[model samples]
Target chain A: MSAARVGVVTFPGTLDDQDAARAVRLVGAQAVPLWHADRDLKGVDAVFLPGGFSYGDYLRCGAISRFAPLMEEIVPAAKAGLPVIGTCNGFQILCEAHLLPGALTRNASLHYVCRDQRLRVEQTATAWTNTFAAGQEIVLPVKHGEGRYVADADTLAALEAGDHVVVRYLGGNPNGSLNDIAGIRNEAGNVVGLMPHPEHAVEELVGAPSTDGLGFFTSILKNLVNA
Target chain B: MARVIVDVMLKPEILDPQGQAIARALPRLGFSGVSSVRQGKRFEIELEGAADEAALAEVRKMAETLLANTVIEDYSVRVEG
Candidate 1:
């Protein structure tokens, strides 16, 4: 089977685009670099918006990057069932774009945090998390200042009803995110946004005891193959 | 043109550890009566025309659709001529 083409978008000040691309390569997929200013999708099978302090996190973490030219195209593609994953700042952009509900606020402590976190996969139906069994626990790296997730009572109820909550922090709440949610999926389940940095944890040598982060990239490949 | 000022803040139910930390530090700095501090974002939007009902509606749409999350953050818009 041919390798799936996964595009990793890089906005100005993006910090993890390279790591995301490498993760894709490690998972046997072609990693395509996408520039924020480019409107084209490059015919990639899947897309990942890597973590970063896009636009210097000026107005908000993902605020300025949401207006980037690429989002104009990505937003439509994501709605049409294209698989997209956003990590950390990328998750903020997804929220800013309205592709996903909820917003990431400053860490309850309001201080920048960096740590290895354990997360439980709550749903395995999304394109970016299908490889994991439901309720599986995996360790990945999380680094950010604004990572707390907040949603309205009604929206939170709706998300629970739809089973859209994807991943939750295991053990301790890292940033005081509501419900300890580390990640979530859109109603379509094709788009996912998470606070953790799976790309940075893909290699066991550099990250935790296992290469659990590889599941994210591998999941997308399986989703494309099955589709 | 009309101007719309939108203030966005984290919901009160959620703990504001950052705010508490600052509040704690204030008393130590010898500045009495510094009760509290809550951090948030403020946006100033200039409308296409004078502040009016119609322009305010457009600004509201912008806030709901993009400017604010409306989930954990509450936004209030004030219109001024």
Candidate 2:
């Protein structure tokens, strides 16, 4: 069978599109580069919104990018069960697009934080996380100024009820996310948004102590192969 | 003209470590009797030519649907002549 095509979107100021595409290729999938101005999804099997300061982080992290022409197509595609993953600024974009719940605000300390963060896989049922066992700890890079996730009580309850809380900070809460949540998945389990940068941690030589981030890419490939 | 004030916050049940950290620091800063602080964002929007109730409704819809997360926040709209 042919390899699954994973599109990594590149916004004007995106910094990690190449890393995400490389991660996809490392996991035996074809990585397609997508542009924010392009309206077509290019018939990719899945998509990844990689991290970066899109549009210079003006207005809000992902607020401007949500209106990108590509998102017009991506929103419906994602709703139709096309796998989608967002990291950092991409996560901010997903929330702005209303594809995910909550908003990412300035860090509680009001500073840009960059670190190798420890996160636990809270839910392994999502298309991007199926390779991980529940409660598995992984280290990934988190670099952002406004990474704090905020949502109302009912929404938080609903997410918990739906098992959409995908990843939680294992030790220190990096950006003051509620319940130590570092990532979340949509109700369909095909779309996920995460604050940490899994793409940055996919290689053992350059990444954390363990190359745990590759599982995210491999999980999507595995899902596509199984489907 | 109609003025809308939107306040966004994390749900009360969820822990606000930032708030907690600030609350804990207040005592050390020599600010006695400062009991607590919960941080949130406030948006003040003024609508022009939106004097009618219909216009007000439109602005409210915008706030509910995009400007704010209703799950953790409650917004109130005030109309002034």
lDDT of 2 at B17: 58
Candidate 2 — which residues are off by over 4 angstroms?
A207-209, B1-81
Clashing pairs counted in every model: 1, 2
**How do the residues A125-218 of candidate 2 rate in per-residue lDDT, one tens digit apiece?**
9999999988898888889888888887788899988899999887788777777889999999999999998898888877365688899999
TM-score of 2: 0.81
Candidate 1 interface RMS: 2.5
In model 2, pairs of residues that clash are A152-B71, A152-B72
Q: Per-residue CA lDDT of candidate 1, range B1-81, in tens?
A: 667898877677656677788889888988788777876778999777787888888888888766776666668889754
- Model 1 DockQ vs. reference: 0.53
lDDT of 1 at B8: 78
The global C-alpha lDDT for each of the candidates, from Candidate 1 onward, is 0.88, 0.85
- lDDT score, candidate 2, position B39: 66
lDDT of 1 by residue, A73-182 (tens): 99999999999999999999999888999888878877788888889999999999999999999998889889998887888889888999999999788888988989
Q: Residue A114 in candidate 2 has what lDDT? A: 89
